[model samples]
Target: MEKGSNHTPKALEKMRQRKWSKATRAKMQGKSHSAETRAKMSASHSGKTLTPEHRENIRKALLGHKISPETRAKIGKAALGHTRRLGMKHTPETIAQISATKLQPENRAKARAKKLGSNNPAWQGGISREPYGWEWDEPLRESIRKYDGYKCRVCGVPQMECDVALNVHHINYAK
Candidate 1:
């Protein structure tokens, strides 16, 4: 007969009926999913996630779609080139189709820059900027030379190859 007594049961029912989004479910189950279940889920989820009927409908819709012959040729050429460059025996037709799609110039440049950046020493686990309190002294420099085989560890061009004398680097200057 108490008005506030209803609130406690209502809140408990609401908590029991709580629904978690897929992301929240995933995070809550973090690092605890069984390997077999995880593998099954991963394999099942490895697609566009469209139903067969929906995909068929989309296919029917695009049945009359047209692309320029020149665009088609460029895509085929690029796919073939990729296969040759990668030494791959087979290039997926789906990959060719995706590449044929239009992309912004900036997006293309960013992709190219990313690919190039991966090859650069500074980006590929190489040190950037001078170390704190870096200095050159006889014992320290000799230790550096010995540790690095008298070569620049970052650029790998060799300390002897450097026009400027290489300096000894301390990992923790405050220490």
Candidate 2:
């Protein structure tokens, strides 16, 4: 295919459907480019920078693309044992520079506004803070502890045998 040539969806689908013989696939398997060729390819694109428009175009092109499970597994396997920046730490000067950028008045205001209740993206209308139930009180907890013989169901240890206080937890929150 020529560089920058248009490949319509139908053409691309046809290419994907076409399967080469096993021998043809095997011929190119486990092959590496020559050192000189690799050097030339690297040098051709060294120190290149993409314009803002080009970056935006690439981002938009990939916005809604989904990777197959096979591809995702391969990526996970490839990254299993790699650490990109092992033991790396910013110097005091670099830390100061970052703090100065974050401490700007506009940046501080934006951060503070984002953390405001209801205004925050994670806000859930304060449902988490609502009381559980009238029955979910200290008396009910003590009754459950007595019913369980003052012992942990999982550990089988009596509350009197341990220094830490024992708690009776509800098995079902909705109840």
Candidate 3:
């Protein structure tokens, strides 16, 4: 479901013909959800992209609509608190609820599957398992460490602070 692409006539007709259950319609009619439910609903839709057809339909629907003054005033009134809420911090419970689905084992497995191997952003064509170059000996590592002042080049943590000797890394990861 991307921009510039749309369903065929058959698919569109099928979607149009789909009917909601009476119970579902009754449940949704003239009813507003609690704040927690609203928050959860908002969180679920956060990263989804609307297709171009949906955008066009919305544009066409609003093209010639005239807003009555009373309706316009109500809309403006409702938006007044939106700016105030922009920088508000979420409570611990809210944060936990938003992240609950992400912490589930099935979701974790799906995320891992999505990012595996060549699909991953950091993928380097399986070079990580390659053996080091012949010249990569312990003496050379020690020399490099000594040359670097026996500290981590990135974090500046000295060798003595670590339980083990500092590890020397190849900058280009060629080794």
Candidate 4:
């Protein structure tokens, strides 16, 4: 289908509900755009920028969408054995040059500044450093662990069987 074509809500809903048979899907699998068509498509989108309203609409549409496990597995299998820049390596001299550039005082200061306090994009005003409530004591934690039979809730692995310590996580972090 062509990009950004307008359709009625009913038509769009119908399209969403429509499913193609395997034969139809197989027939379309290896199709490629003609050079002229490709040029036209490129020209159509060359200078387009989505408006805030359009961007918000797209965000809302995709807000809670999830990939099915079958689709996830297909994506994983498709990417298997792919190595980006395979066999590429920096020479010792090139590594030294890179190290020297990064170690320069100005470069070090810039990197440090990016991660300092509220200057960091991810800073949350030290909220994460606040202590847990009084109800979240070690005894409460141990009781919860015992209630769960001392096993990982997600993987069902017993604490005794795991190489690392098990932790109880709050699924809903509303507080």
Candidate 5:
């Protein structure tokens, strides 16, 4: 509509005259648009790309939006096994990006610091801090690693491939 013509007396009269009845509005409430209308709507949005600023605006708008528990559960249930690459491996670039992200020990500490002691799932009422008559030194640990061919006893990962030292747990846990 022409900007100045929209609120003209004739246009106001036309709009007031075209108001739908309550019954007509009720009938349209649950009804969808016709195929032609849907096609026109789709065409109007086709080939339109959001500008970077618009995309940033959208991101900022949704930054702190919270989903209710029920909505989150529904979304999770709907998303189960629906990934485009459900069972595929991450590409090398993704793996590199992930490794780079995890390279900082400070980030790992900051994350775990929130869930230590009583807040942790394996808290065990602080029993983990109690030594179970076990006092193996670094030399003993090295011997155990040497005995195990310098690789992970379970997954068989080589010691050199591990970022940290190989842990040799007690026999009960080594099982």
Candidate 6:
């Protein structure tokens, strides 16, 4: 018996209370830890550096994991066929609209340049001097009145009933 176990007071205490087994002692010790300590332990383990041999082992494990060329070709063929089927059903105008929306990088750049030029006073000279486009037009007012049924376009309330004059707004000022 251990020195503590041989003592009369300790032996008496052990007799009075049931002694925990080794497995029970281990389980109790495991359950004694606080949640904060467990999180810190998990975080510390996550930062551990793997050995070169371990990395090599992982690489070897994933060596044959890629999709084969034949499988890739099959997937590619299926996708192309699916796209062709979908595209074939679309009307020419629909296709044209879709194609127009997908502007090339160069086209996008030109558009951005044009927009910036129009907005920036420094580049104002680069654009046309004509001030008569969509802005400040009697025709625009007429169109807005027609679209809104002679109602205030700002609040969508009737223009005849409202106190304020209907302000024709180009919803997107970017235009």
Best by lDDT: 3
Q: Better model by TM-score, 1 or 4? A: 4
Instruction: Indicate which candidate wins on TM-score.
Output: 2
- Provide TM-scores for the models: 0.21, 0.34, 0.32, 0.33, 0.30, 0.21
The 10 consecutive residues of candidate 6 with the worst lDDT sum are 127-136
Residues 70-153, candidate 6: write the lDDT tens digits. Answer: 999999988874654654588899989878876777778886777685566666565453644546577876786777788754
Model 2 earns a TM-score of 0.34
lDDT of 5 at 90: 93
In model 1, the worst 10-residue window by lDDT is: 125-134
**lDDT of model 6 at residue 81?**
43
Model 1 bad stretches (over 4 Å)? 1-48, 84-175
Candidate 1 lDDT score at position 137: 42
lDDT (tens digit, per residue) of candidate 5 on 34-118: 9999999999999999999999999999999999999999999998978797689999999999988877899788878888889
Candidate 5 local Cα displacement, residue 4, angstroms: 10
When summed lDDT is taken over every stretch of 10 residues in candidate 3, the lowest stretch is 15-24
lDDT per residue for candidate 2 within 46-125, as digits (tens), equals 99999999999999999999999999999999999799778989999999999999999999999998899998788898
- Pairs that collide, model 2: none
Model 4, poorest ten-residue lDDT window? Answer: 166-175
lDDT of 6 at 131: 49
Query: In model 4, what are the clashing residue pairs, if there are any?
Result: none
